[model samples]
Target chain A: METKIRQLSSNLDPRYFQIVVLSALLLYGVAILDFGIRWQNAIAIMLTAQFVQLVGTRAVQLPRFDPLSPLITSLSLTLLLRTDDVRLAILAACIAIGSKFVLRVRNKHIFNPANFALVSMMLLSDHAWVSSGQWGSAAIGAFALACLGFIVLTRAKRAETTLAFLGCYAALVFGRALWLGDPLGIPLHQLQNGALLIFAFFMISDPRTTPNTAAGRILFAALVTAVAGTIQFIYFQPNGPILALILCAPLVPVIDSLLKGRNYRWEQPKGVL
Target chain B: MRILATIAAAALTVAISATAQAFCGFYVAKADTSLFNKASQVVLVRDKDRTVITMANDFEGEVEDFAVVIPVPTKIEREQINVGDRAIVQHLDAYTSPRLVEYHDADPCMDYRHFEMSMDSAAPQAAVLEEARKVARSRGVTIEASYTVGEYDILILSANESSGLVSWLQDNDYKLPKGAERVVDSYLKQDMRFFVAKVNLKEQSKLGYQYLRPLQVAYESNKFMLPIRLGTLNADGKQELYVYALTRTGRVETTNYRTVKLPSNVNVPEFVEGEFADFYRAMFDKQVEAENERAVFLEYAWDMAWCDPCAADPLSAQELRELGVFWTGGRGGSKIAPMPAQDVFVTRLHVRYDGEHFPEDLMFQETGDRQNYQGRYVIQHPWKGEPSCDISQYQAQVRERQEQEAQQLANMTGWDIDDIRKKIPFPEGDAPVQEPWWKRIWG
Candidate 1:
């Protein structure tokens, strides 16, 4: 198992694999599902994200330019965000890469870059929205998780947050179904959403933004899940996970303060493709 | 050849090229709700927590035997219920229906000027549909309120248990659908109340009405959803439903299910103009199959102020008020006003659902998306008249367009390409690319 892990993580950053997966999904959505993502908007977002990344690199006085992070952020923004205006797409990309440089806690950004941009754009303008149902409930769901599992398994030390979040979220969902006397299919269908899977395996599992200790990460995941369920079932809003991640983001610093564990750096062992 | 564009077509083209209009469609014959057997129509007017729902069923049976028990989010009073005009509902259907548009090949010798044509929906009078119900007081089921609205007796009932509601309904001769007990229990657990309505023969006679009008109820709740599980409980096959949402802010969509836009803006053969209804039905079935029978098809989404072809003149202001456009005015009905300047946005959704395919009820969310859309199928009429100038090039374009239309129709409705071609009157060998026999041997 260790040899297999070494083979997977030896040569590349995991962000590159994420970029590949998200790009393939975006292409699939555009070509097959007709997801209504305008190519002009996509290009504007891509160019603007890299531009912001370059500006951030120079402003922060970093030694080298890192295109992988911006590329990942741009791909994710394209996959999740839906809009007609080219300007909104560019604004969203700028917000995404820009927040990573501005919003920090203990040298760690508070929110996942893509999650921050999605929520900010949704709250700021009516022109931009997230279509959670865009990914649809299909067999592609399991395939998505399988590909996502590579990043989780390769970064075993950080997989706790993702696993805990999915476990707690699934438990609450099934519990609600049982309480409501709903068919099992309902929760199963909810679980199969490609957006939810992406949230579990990618956005929520961002190591830098998570609690440092395993216990703290699990607690944070559970808390976020509960809050998200309230937003969805009680308040009757869409994209509960995206909103919940932001609402719970500030607690990560507090969790690290209390738990006192190792800090994360991408270059340190876990960030391989 | 000197090709002079028609005055109307030229103006329309200039307008289209100038404005980049979000949506355009010609008014044509619509496949109205009446086309589907046992289909139900619902108009949902919502803003914030407030909602007004109008339900109309095409029930073809004895009036005394028609009864329905609906789970409402809150208890409604007598003033909350009203009998609405069926013409308005029919008009809404006409306004948002998938339409057929045709353009005559503008004297091919002259510049072909293609323009849009549209028609208005005429309101139809409400007709009688029947429901069966009786009264038997029970301990667990409490009738909180009772009133007479139009030709129907209305009652608001709150129940403590599903079995209590079921027994109360059965004891009263309501003839509730089999397996409704589970759904009733579920609704009760959610703290929902039941609204029951049945025809009153004496009221029908005194009101001098032959048909049952649509019933409207207004209430305030955070839940923007439709409970359809009960409707599917007794169905032997799939049941068709049409939901027309009128909102002050923007469009409403099914949150739990995928809302897919129906195939639109495609051209078919000119023969489709004659059988537009059949073409729509076949295309709808094809779409339903393609989505694996699990999606809600968005038939139309447009601003209430105006339509491209003005399908039914965007509903008069008074008509809008009657359909439960609460913000049109204070109660919103005084005089007939012009349209496309109003604040209301309408979204029409259609679904063919059964318990097996659609296990959960439809939950809706109103989005601030005011982008306009409509299902429009076009047909380009060929110029049968002889061309006076260098119009041979235009004729070739027409032939190619006609062949493409044949393939499109085949693709949309899954009809055989050969069969579709058989119906199309192609211009000589222009479509099939025929050549002389000598060319096959020597060239």
Candidate 2:
């Protein structure tokens, strides 16, 4: 019993918090907010993700088959990816978990699994698209607050990425508003978008894909923010932040190499790295 | 040989009829925007960089005092601007309006088949529903072009500074809104020009049109957006704007704001047929509130060829061209058959916006999501006539369905549950025979 307690407290996994919060958000979106996620798509993603993860685990020859990470990736895919085809949904799940095994340098995945799958499917098919503005201000505000609180509650291990991304993105929005001589309300409204919130808290702050060091992570976050802003304002495109992340994903290894430090590990303490 | 050919012809006819019934439903009443006060309607047609915009004025105010300022992405030439027929827009509205489709039940005892008939819920026969003026250049403000279109004088103005434009408007007695200067300044910085129009009293009298037709302008630019900031500058609380977008693509949605589908295709109490407008308004209000009053709701998204339950007949090619659908390839003002549906897709978007709720101009994108959707409600009227067999089981099931519909109606419109139940006409001995506590306990 003492050994069990020690083991449990010794590795207080953040995945548990993430799972709870993300599930709550999914529930809120489906039941209360009426987000456009089909039940079949959700089930297809959930099963296909685990199946892909199992295949990937065997290929990589890993000792343990951890369902937690794949579950998180599958949930994120379900939340972000919108498609009518069950085949597309299954493909997205495969790409999401499969990327972690295939696309890597020095045992580190280059892209966030969910982000990679989203960008890949979007580039490939017309049916796959992201509803970035599906979350209204009411939900955005609630989501943003909840995400911030989640970060705080978790002690924000490797949270510099999320903080820097949100800060830089907010700055760019306000800066654009100021330059246009538009009202502050515009930037405030833009910043309170739920997609941006999800990107910052869940997708961007994923420990595996971000740079190792805090400084490297911050710099990476700022660059992603700048690219996203240009795509949105200059190119007049939707889902700017999402596409920006994919575009700047290859730079993660570069950032990690330049600011050389230990890589991120799950369920680790703040000072571990 | 003659008998065989005749039999083949009859079979083909039957096949066609069956398919028609499958794909089509009766268009009952329509729930148009006449239910809302101070509603404005706009029809936007965009392909690549070219856009043709039509603004319908339910102005109901003094024609002389009515003036509108819209921002254009590019400079408009005289030939690019024209006054559109208001009847075509009403036709488009009626065609795409949210409708009620009724499906009457047959005797439960007999084998049955279903049929559908569609009609406009509220045929807005009431609506058949623009002008331009001259301008002087000064203070870096250039009146690029000016002309009279129908009953109004139009001006295409490009200003270097917002204050110059604002002063010019004020000088001309345009009565610019209080915060229009800032928005104009922003648009000017973005390299946008102002398309200003005022009632041409002399032209109006000459034309003798008591009502203002829709003002239309075709321009080529990459910005597929609507300038609502200037309109939002008005401090008269939230404004209702309906956008009917006709495109070659699937659907049009706001990039900056959530384009949500309103509560649709739900069963309501049969009596709702009489008060559909009220039901629609309440349901819409509930949805808008639920979304925190910041979403643009999609009322209908359907192909221009046909409607399942048509609120109004689909617009022909001639009518579409009159509404500035230039790509329809029927420019000789000749009528085209409404068969084999047109390439045009229609997306009807409704937004209730205030400055606080909608801070930015609406940015729209054409998505490939061609899945047809509409704000439709249903009333499954139960068979009331005597059945050839016992109808006790049918009556029991009808009571259950009625209760469920009552609950659904209450949830959708936030109406009182008891009130909905009272409105619901349940069969005699309405309550489901719930097993008594004593019986259940013993069992």
TM-score of chain A of each: 0.90, 0.91
TM-score of chain B of 2: 0.82
Kindly list the per-residue Cα lDDT of model 1 for residues B321-394, writing each as its tens digit: 87778787633433354444388899999877777777778888777677899888777788777667887667
Q: Candidate 1 chain A, which ten residues in sequence have the lowest lDDT sum? A: A264-273
Report the number of backbone clashes for model 1: 22
* True-vs-predicted CA distance for residue B53, candidate 2, Å: 2.1
Q: lDDT, candidate 1, residue B105?
A: 71
- Report iRMS (Å) of candidate 2: 1.6
- Docking class of predicted structure 1: acceptable
- Tens-place lDDT per residue, model 2, B48-103, is 78899887654444566555566776777877777876666666766777777777
TM-score of 1: 0.86
The per-residue C-alpha lDDT of model 1 at residue B310 equals: 45
Tens digits of per-residue lDDT for model 1, A56-100: 999999899998888888888888888767888999999999999
